[model samples]
Target: MASTSSFDIVSDFDRQEMVNTVDQALREIKSRYDLKDTKSTLELQENAILVNTDSEFALEAIHTILRTKAAKRNLSQKIFDYGKVESASGSRLRQEITLKQGISQDLAKKISKLVRDEFKKVQASIQGDVVRVSSKSKDDLQNVMQRLKQEDFPLALQFTNYR
Candidate 1:
């Protein structure tokens, strides 16, 4: 009998890094002459972020700052689902940015199917939001990881819990 090696594919981000990203962006907004005194604000929610500002230009600046900070922190740009700008009181504009957190069932199914079709030595199973891949050969597992990385997925993928 042979033992199998396995790993889990998950889509996640570091919450503390996100908090730091937002804090850094807020500091930049306060110091930047164009954004300063524009009353720009960034608020992080449980699963989203809220931005409020006086003008469209300021809003754009905030977005740039946010993106730059997030990138520097190694967060995927795809995580942000930007909402349309809405009117707020006293010539203010507001926008909501949603955070992408998990893999959908459809995507997990697609990944499992792909692995099953392409790799005879590998077995993939969908366990909740994660896809678990196992193989007797560690080389086969590495090949599976490489193949998955090549395919474009909407959310970021992190392989964990290797055993």
Candidate 2:
């Protein structure tokens, strides 16, 4: 009989990476020639980022910087939800970029399906937002993990609950 163990596959968003990327982007914006003299500001908050610029062109530049940073950090570009631009002091426009954490419901289902499809010999079940895989043999479980890494899911997935 094959011995069985269970593990959960979850994506733990890397908050530190996001913060680091934001810091780097801020530095670049500060030193950039055109933005150096503008009355622009970038601020990070718990739920979103606030970017204020003197003109639309500067706002576009800031958006580009943010997108680049998000990509560099392996974050999905889909997470950025642009809020309405509000008029700030001195005719400046302030834009808020909302950051979303946690895998979406659809993504969770997709991941669960992927795990099951890839490891045909193993059984996979979706528990809330995580995928739990069970196999009788340790080798089979290891093989599944290897295959998952090869597939390269968007989120940073982790495995747990091995029994």
Candidate 3:
């Protein structure tokens, strides 16, 4: 057996699932009486989802629907960063929700520090967008995973490449 075992900590979400969530929400918007015929539009752009609706009320409804759909699909709610609502042409309102993918430098450092402070036997190093954690004992790695899940971070975290 290898002397050391390791895993990578990442913060990411499924783009296809996000797209599906948006599509389902739009369909519900069309069927609902309050949102139907509002000429509202929801589009999943390259990095963000764009929501165009007639009023703030309608946009709020869309937000609820989108969040609900995402939850049903097992997508993390923390991935959405909602932008300010702005007025578009023809009195339409627009909102952009940016999708958070990787862990930021500040967050990465925080995670590394957390692991080091908690687990002396484990070693954590930040590698670009992901954090690599390794230790000789597999039990230490399992404890680290359990500890991380208890924390309420701003983003969703996933563990991968465990060996």
Candidate 4:
């Protein structure tokens, strides 16, 4: 029997890069004029980043800062894994942003479904928070990759584990 060539498709968001970007954004916030007074805050949990601000404007400014920093470092906005912004307290709002590397099980399932539906040639299965794609022919796998790239998925995708 011929061994099938297989690969895992996922978003390419380096966790370390994101951490570094967040650190730089924090530093910039402290130094920037408009942001300095707002006292915006950022915290990285296991799977997500928590942002807190005094007002909506401050929250947006912080978001912009994070986005710019990530973009400058070649990180995609799709990796942001954005969550809904909600009121935390009086004049305070909070946003929890998920990381592509630490994707939620629900999102992972969604991705796997998308890949299976979008790529008819390859077989895809959700393994924990990651999706595995396998195909007998490398050409089929390559075609799947190309199709994935053409579509706009909500989350950042990184391809890995090709064999």
Cα lDDT computed for each candidate against the true fold: 0.94, 0.80, 0.94, 0.81
lDDT: which is higher, 2 or 3?
3
Q: How accurate is candidate 3 locally (lDDT)?
A: 0.94
Note the residue pairs that clash in candidate 3: none
Question: Using TM-score as the measure, which candidate wins?
Answer: 3
> How do all the candidates rank in terms of lDDT, highest first?
3, 1, 4, 2
RMSD of each: 1.0, 3.7, 1.0, 3.2
Q: Write the per-residue lDDT of candidate 4 for residues 1-163, one digit (tens) a residue.
A: 8678888866567778888999999999899888888778999887789998888888888889999999998898876767999888767888998876645677777666876787676788877666788978899888887877786767777788888
- In model 2, pairs of residues that clash are 3-136
Error of 2 at 72 (Å): 4.3
- Candidate 2 vs candidate 4: the TM-score winner is 4
- Against the correct fold, how does model 2 do in TM-score? 0.68
List model 3 lDDT by residue over 35-154, tens digit each.
Answer: 898989999998799999999899999999999999999999999999999999999999999988999999999999999999999999999999999999999999999999999999
lDDT of 2 at 30: 91
Per-prediction count of colliding residue pairs?
0, 1, 0, 5
